[model samples]
Target: MSTAAAELRSQRFAAAVPDLERIEAMPLLAEIDALKRARNAVVLAHNYQAPAIYHGVADFTGDSLALAQQAARSEADVIVVAGVQFMAETAKLLNPTRMVLISSLAAGCSLAESISAADVRALRRRHPGVPVVSYVNTSAAVKAESDICCTSANALRIVESLGVPKVIFLPDRYLGHHVQQ
Candidate 1:
């Protein structure tokens, strides 16, 4: 590494020293690591997670879609999601055969909460042949009810690809509206 890069790395480590010290003071970080090894699990944390969880225990940390993609591609027997419930569900959706666990069941996202599986089912019943597209922010159950799943970045193409004049897009009204436009 260049001298400047080395100095920057040192500075970054120095800045994180306090947080690292706190993590080291407890057995949580060590236990989590040990558990990962024992269970052959890969922990995927979102960018919004706590620094300790993100920097300390997470094997991969990124956005929801990125984390889900990583979890889908991971060779581990188990996957741990250190974000909201929907994120864990997303991982499970992608890796249906793998064991997916959430760091905390209490963690939730407002967008995910906006729709439920029953609601999607009801929409399908009403629409009959119209395709249902679910945003990735939704729960796995919701995704299962839909014809396809899409991310914010690919919402337009996903919607258009269905080749339907009218399709149901759930959870995020704004995104659905954008796709409609």
Candidate 2:
């Protein structure tokens, strides 16, 4: 990493430390506790989520997959994921019997949008019978419509594991381009 970027990150850490200490000494957490009980819901937040939302509201927090896995294991009737649409869809895909809600559908992800089911189907037509390996960052409708799901960290493994000569990866042109290389 560049020194500038490293310095900027260090500055961010320095800026956040004082506020974190203050929050730790406050009664805000108590209020959030009451809200959680009243809502009868559990928040599975992403690491990228705002500190107030992540630390204040989230009962379980982690990366996209980790939070989704937690949601699947949680007993809460209402699961509110303070992340993007794909993350929420992942929760729905896992816990199909439960209710899942995204804090903001507009909070989109480039990787998730890289491919759609329709795009996959269209590509399939072009390739005749080649398999389509979609990233888990897709809608359930897209997932249900897919051959299988994989993550960015596991994209190549899924490709090699599937043993398909032709592959059509979607929605995120960037992720697709990255995987192709």
lDDT score, candidate 1, position 117: 96
- Each model's total of backbone clashes: 0, 7
Q: How do the residues 1-181 of candidate 2 rate in per-residue lDDT, one tens digit apiece?
A: 2356435544544455467664563476466556657767778889998766664556777898798779878887788899999899888878888888888979988766766668777777888777777777787767866787777788878877878666777655567688778
| Model 1: per-residue Cα lDDT over 1-181, one tens digit each | 2356435534543465576576463477667667877899888989997766666667778999999889878989999999999898778877889999998989999999989999998988888999999999988789888899999999999998988899999989999999888
Worst 10 residues of 2 by lDDT: 1-10
Instruction: Provide the TM-score for each candidate, comma-separated.
Output: 0.84, 0.75
Highest-TM-score candidate? 1
Model 2, stretches more than 4 Å misplaced? 1-32, 172-181
Candidate 2 is scored at a TM of: 0.75
Location of the lowest summed lDDT over 10 successive residues in candidate 1 = 1-10
